[model samples]
Target: MVKFGVLVLLSAIAIGQGETTIESQCQVCQEENNVYCESESTFLRMRGAMKLGPLSCEADEVCSNSGNLCKKKTEITNEVLNVCGANCQSCSADRKYTCVSRNQAALCLNGQASSTIIIDCGEDEVCVDDDDGKAFLCVPSCVADYQKLSVPCSSAAFTTPTPAPPTTPSGDNQKSICQAAAVNKKTLYFFTYADSSCRTYVYCERSSSTSTDFTTTLSGSCSSPNPYFNTVSGKCQASVPDNCESEAPST
Candidate 1:
């Protein structure tokens, strides 16, 4: 047979606080001002019953302290599971499309869900986080190349009936000069027009060991009117021509 005990506090304060009574089979000590002496023991037993061990014990008199502790524990457990989950792998999508993890899927293009394809790239591969928290496909290299088209007119050409400049290089054309000098040899570079002409200047540096690997390859033209390099994404961007920009230039 098990023993039972009913402990009752007859104080008016206890009655008003609804803490006047406690029923249990174990030894329990009571305190004034609505405090319970054996509260830790009761809480430990409750946690044990739930298979959580004594980790649920509170460190302060208020329940908020215990709640915070439990919440922190839950967060740690979740982080471990997410990073080390059995299905841990890279994800991919189509051209002009991107994908990220479910937790970060909102950051994807137009806040859409990531595609189901899992890329085989390693963790070191470059990637972007969509607004939804999903990691999207990104390029790994920093260097890129693009072809430009242009038709130049000479200053000496027809004032009233001047003929158009030759379609080919004339040994004095700026484009031919740059092409002969190989000024655009560098892989990662940015180009922009000057004086509203077809002359495009490039910005770049020699590759080094610490170069940054760009992740996303944007197809649209940059909206800004200047050509500048983005250090964070390692890409060169132009302000004109909508949607033809490459991924960030490599550092």
Candidate 2:
């Protein structure tokens, strides 16, 4: 199989053709970060091509647009800005790239622990560290010596609340879940969708300071590697559950 990196190099070559070519004067960053694309050409080329570098900046380093590559935080002459925006609070660089598994990874946005986004490698890709082992990257599974790559953290390093199903639930149904919890006097509750499809689940919680009041706090479709939502465990699992009413949702 063609490697993802090789495919990127091919796309870069193709972009140079016709009007899509990037010129020397283009005001673009010399390097790309794991989160955002720095150059318009690079961004355009990678929009749907494949996953690109999820490179991270060191604790003392900041992603600089200049050609010298990453620069020390102290060297910045202006206010420091997080590319991921305000919601992501600053955290240590050690939490930057978390490996959920060889095929899955999560990026600590703006170095923030609470704000993380999962990075699912392509079907043929696997998560691995860069040559320097300073950043987490996704490469073709066929690449050799992948086990030698560094893994910044284990699955326990960061965990996101199970995502709700892609389909929005009816208001009455959402209210019902919370109402059941409230009636049971349960502070928190997790339950599978009525259809018992492995794709989605609901997480409900009682409103603070209101014992009788409850609300649906979060819900979303289970992601890759753990696509099936096991009703008994109230979490996504790798295997099919006996109660599953449907196969995993199409990607």
Q: How does each model score on TM-score?
A: 0.16, 0.30
**Model 1 stretches with alpha carbons more than 4 Å out:** 1-104, 107-177, 180-199, 203-222, 225-251
Candidate 1, 1-251: lDDT as tens digits = 12112111112111122222111111111121111111111111121222111111222211111222212224434122112111111122422322222211112233232333233323222222222223333322121001111001111111111111123222233333333323434444222221222212222222432333322111111123434333223233453333224321121
The digit string of per-residue lDDT tens for model 2 on 1-251 reads 11122111112111111222111111122234322322111111122433222222333344443333345655544333322211111234445543444455555555443333555666665554332223456566554233333322222222333222345445466566445434434444435443345555444445463454554333444567877666555555788787664422232
Give all candidates' CA lDDT scores. 0.22, 0.39
RMSD of each: 32.0, 17.6
Question: Cα deviation of 236 in candidate 2 (Å)?
Answer: 1.1
Question: In order, how many clashes per candidate?
Answer: 29, 7
Poorest lDDT segment (10 consecutive residues) of candidate 2: 37-46
Candidate 2 local lDDT, residue 112? 40
lDDT of model 2 at residue 157?
24
Our model 2 lands, by Cα RMSD against the true structure, at: 17.6
